[model samples]
Target chain A: MITKFRGLVVAGAVALALSQPVMAENVEVDPWEGFNRAMFNFNDGLDTYALKPVTKGYKAVMPDMAEEGVHNFFENLADIGTLINNLLQGKFENAGKDFARVSFNSTFGLAGFIDVASPMGIEKHEEDFGQTFGYWGASSGPYVVLPFFGPTTVRDGIGMYPDTLVDPVYHLDDTGARNALYLTRVIDTRAQLLASEKLISGDKYTFIRDAYLQKREFDIADGDVENYDESNF
Target chain B: MLNIIEGEMLMKKSLIALAVAGALTAPMVAQADATLYGSFRVALMSADDQDLDLRDESTRIGIKGDVDLGLEGTKGLFHWEGQLETTDSDAYDAGTGTFAARLAYLGATGDWGTALAGRQYHPHYLWVNIPTDIFNTATSDAGEWAQLGNNQHKRQDNTLAYLTPVMGGFQAALGLVIAGSGDDADDDVDGYNVAAKYSANGLYLAASYGDVDAIDRETWGVAATYDIDALKLVARYEEQENAGVEDEATEVGAIYNFGEGLSAKLRYSNLELNGNDGDQWAAEVEQKLGKGRVYVGYFDYDSDAEALAAKYVDRLAIGYRVDF
Candidate 1:
């Protein structure tokens, strides 16, 4: 079953990749707007009815220090992906910094509970397979909303498969421990985002879509926003 | 001419390299098709005046997979499960800390339906008995009722089965016991079973019948479950006839989810064996943590028959279970 499902996913991604034009102008990116909206609504309903209440209860019960520790631990684990992606993108200096951050946080920072590397001026780089693919000249393709996973472009959606394979947490031999860590990470992330809901105004879908697209562009360009033509807006 | 020949040679070398890379990566991708899973369960129980005993409550490991048949909408399936004994007791008749095969089966599925062979679960047990078998313990649950006067109610070896594709919330299965060993040592087809189930809108209903020629027993059961939000209610009724003796059982159960990984389960069963009356009830509270659970349960059994009273006892158990 797993094999068949994955085969379908890979086949679909290849089909989508072939159908899309190479490096088309970044206008009308959301050609599948109808499908995206329906999926977005489905995800929003699930979060509102199920995940939100559970996260609320988790936040109410967990101590602040413990929550922060959990969040930092996952973030520290995420550096492994960032380091590998940086190397893939030919960002050797950033990859070195990422390595140092992981080393310092895992040891002196007590498994990343303390931001010792940040204070030491070691930068944190957010890089993933999606950004790596973008750096290698893969078009972002049409926007899509995945079930449970939320927003992504067609290229980024395919990139997620490789990212999961490289993720340290996904490689944990103990399934119970892995699942516990995953659940904790999700709850911690939701808890962090709870306060940010107030910042969203107007059409929630459009606001999130625009923010996500811009962020992807910024990450792909390595924060050199000046490369984008002013007239493109 | 020399440059073209060198280019062709280089192309051949790169093609060989690509084939080698594909060979190396193919198995890694195929690994996703098969799943390795296990559940480790240990419990501490105190029954009546017995000392505190640590027990392995059905700890097991298994691997299951689906292999694409290279045909449209068809796949081959296989599963092998084994019990892992964790305690110093001969609970499974295999000595302490021994491995015992629980289920081993091979099957095929397609858009048409599914067909399975080898040792597998009884259709009666899957469709009828499971609705009320919510407790996490091996000894205390609705399974006891299904086992009365019929040992083959749970699973049987040398079995062949066919299941129909579900159509509008309904499906059906037929199973035949081709041969068996030990208590069921029949040289030919000794039993046949049929089950049907319907599920929709949080409600499930099922019924099954099994006729075992080796034991001269015929058993039948019906079960139903209705779910409302976080609350689920289940009920089952079973009857067995063997050598002019009749046994009957009725069970009712409920499980309430309190959200945030907490739930409570309660079950009550009434039994009649050869005109002797017995009743049992169990309750448990479980807290789910990741892919594991910690639970505490209490159960009591009372019987009018001396033999039954001697066999069944009151007990309280605490168990921890983790599944992968």
Candidate 2:
């Protein structure tokens, strides 16, 4: 089941790449505006009708501590991918600390149900193939909204393919169990974001697009962007 | 098991290693600099003709972050805060044992400074109350905000606020609120606040206007402050109007920093509430103590309002606050 989804992601990325030049020429970097807009609307509809309602119900029914533990458990699973990407990006020291963090937490923290890593002087560093690509000087190409995944650029979209291969979820053999875990992770992450939705203004599409691009840049540079100008804020 | 030893070892070694790593890390810019932050504050108060009591003085916690935009200097901003009632003697009445949204807003910033839509503090109230608000309890210029419709527009729901880029030494802000509580047309921009503030080389100046459409009242104020090394001086004047009635106020104060986290200040404020006049005088001292401040102060209030003609009062308070 995991292999099937991975193949689909790769094929979609390849198809998008094959039709790129002519489609993207007129626009600075986003030639797929029409398709992207449609996808954005689709994703928004899903969130409004399915994900949001489920998240609200989940929060209402579960205690904050329990919800937080679920989030931590999934984040611990993500640390493996982060460690791999850190090493790929030549951030050896960060990778080392993160490795220790995961080991310590998984063993004593009951598989990351509790975050014992942070207080142990180990900080979390979220790394992915997308960031690794950006570190190696890959251009972001154009913006694209995935069906259910939401926002991503061409490079990041491709990066997701590689990340899925390394994700523990992809290796889980039981289809139903794996999908349940995946769904829970998605809902948990979305639930955390639900509270911050009140601050949006103007068009949600433009606001999210701009924010996603900027956040990607910040993360890729590991928050060390030399060209940053603070006075703008 | 071996894991237990590893956990204990990591804990013991991390304390020193983390401290050294913390010391070595260079100071970074403010955006997304820290996570999981909150503050704890508790205070004790004794008022004239009232017993001493320990109180919760508006404790708050929040989650906030900013993301840079790849365009011409723009950043996405978000903040969601909650106020909690933690003490038996809560200063705010109707205390409930739960966290309630004190502020929730989302917006963006660029060369235009910042603009947000949602629930947030009014810029007018912020600027006009800057100097006076330094006192932990004084929220804004004059206490008793709801007096004759002179309420400070602290935080209003359904507000669209903007702050202009600081140029030279000037920054300006505006807030427009649509109550969203009533369907009446008068509800739009019913609680608007606007202000302009300037600061440079130890000098600060501000002027603001606030209107409560629902109550048909308007407030305007101007204030200035000058800091000369350890000594600071402030003066302000404000006016309120409702129907045909009017009230005016003036305040002057001085604060002296004794260095090494210690400071002392005194202020006197006088207000003419319609036909009644009243005055409040206060003195305070503060000391900083690691992510927190501890302070004690005294205030004496005398009024000529018919209901309180024989109820002159004095209050003494000691408090401590810490943020993580």
Candidate 3:
């Protein structure tokens, strides 16, 4: 069974590699618009009625320094994934920086609560299997709004499995601790994005969709976006 | 004996291989909200006046999923679990030795409520007995004995259940076991159970009542738990009356986490049946590994009745369990 599954994975990767070239121009591909909108509405309702209030309460009780520390700790753990993706994308320098960030922060930063790597001039890079797939010319198919998971492309949705494997919290032995960490990470992420809500203008859905697409493009292109329009936002 | 050992080893290896394969292939099939999970638990137990033996502790594999029905807010859900027999025992010798069905149910849920059909866990087991079922080994747990006394009030076949959506930390479930299905084919309605629970701020309280018509048994139970930091306290009381023979059980337990994947559990239970009394207690320490744990425990049971005394003996157990 293991061998058969590995063969399937290899075949799938090869098929993805040999598929149609990336559709660079068509970023707003929403073939499942109706389904996506419904899911988006469901997610929005959950966020508004449940998650947002809980996150607000979390933020109100947590000190700013503590919140930052928690955020940095999760970021430090995430660097392990960034390092793997960097290596997969053949960006050895960035992979080395990611390794350095994790090592330094985990040790000198007191388990990443302090983020000493940034002070030491180590750069932090955001990389995932989705970006690696895009780097290898895989097309980001139709935009999808997953329930509770929010927005993603088909390619990125598939990427989530590999990312989950690399997640440190996912490997935690204690179920309670792992779940608490997952909840804390979600609240921290939402708290960080609370300030960015002001930047959204026009239709909230459209704005979020366009911004996510643009951001994916920028990340896939390593921030060297071609024909980027500053006035779009 | 060698063949049995070899078979068990092969099964263990195959299970590990299957888990790895599933983990690898999960990404390609990540379309729906589905999970494939399993737990493999075994214990080496030494009982008074008996030889040490390796035993299976309710090892099970299951798949559960929720699918968006595309309705306004409803989703379809299904769960199926089956126990894998690992020990060399005659208790499961009948054609069901290899694997036995534990839970198989289908349901739909929305804002209004949830309804399910098929064989599933009894509310009496979940809400009432679970508070004190903390031991790693299933054999020595007080909850296990309580269920045994009540004709194994765990899962019932041909059950149709409805659950009310939680409101203000309170939820209620009603289940009806239909006759002319599976085991209870001769009766009109086999049984019915109702359970209610309230959980908030580290405190949980649950109550349940069940009636089995074929056996003419009526059972009721209440359970409560409180959690503070690394410590949890649990207690439960249950009573059953069958053919004018009344049985009562009370259990209390505590769990304390020492951090760093180490924890301690202590539990005590007393059961009074047919004017006879039995007492059981256990203490265990567990060390958690990745998705697994290794534990050692001491259990003692004493009873005034000879039948009960012969069944529930003092034992020391060392166990390992892993879930995926």
Using all chains and alpha carbons, the TM-scores for the candidates as numbered come to 0.52, 0.50, 0.52
- Candidate 1 residue runs with Cα over 4 Å from true position: A1-233, B1-32, B89-97, B140-150, B181-187, B303-309
For residues B1-324, could you state the per-residue lDDT of candidate 3 as single tens digits? 999999999999999999999999988789777889999998877777889788888899999999988899899999989988777667477758555788899999999999999888888887877665777778633226645323557887888999999999999999888862234667767888899999999999999998887767889989999999988998889898877888888888898775556666778888777878878777776667779876767777765523564657777777779999
DockQ comparisons of all candidates to the true complex:
0.01, 0.01, 0.01
> Please, what is the whole-model Cα lDDT of each candidate in the order they appear?
0.81, 0.76, 0.82
Model 3 over residues A1-233: C-alpha lDDT tens digits?
Answer: 99999999999998777663443333348778789889999999999999999989989999999999999999999999999999999986577567656755765477889987675456689999999999999999999999999999999999999999999999999999999999999999999999998899998887798799889999999888988767867
Highest lDDT, which number?
Answer: 3
Q: State the weakest 10-residue window (summed lDDT) of model 3 chain A.
A: A19-28
Return the clash pairs for model 2, or none: A199-B106
Please tell me what DockQ candidate 3 reaches: 0.01
The alpha-carbon RMSD values of the candidates against the true structure, listed in the order shown, are 22.6, 30.8, 26.6
- What tier of docking accuracy does candidate 1 attain? incorrect
Clashing pairs in 3: none
List residue ranges in candidate 3 displaced over 4 A.
A1-233, B1-28, B89-94, B140-143, B148-150, B180-188, B303-307
Model 2 C-alpha lDDT per residue in residues A172-227, reported as the tens digit of each score: 99999999999999999999898777877898887788778888999998887777
TM-score of 2: 0.50
- Residue-wise C-alpha lDDT for candidate 1, range B131-244, written one tens digit per residue: 667887776332253344235567788899999999999999999988754345535688899999999999999999888777688888889999999889999888988767
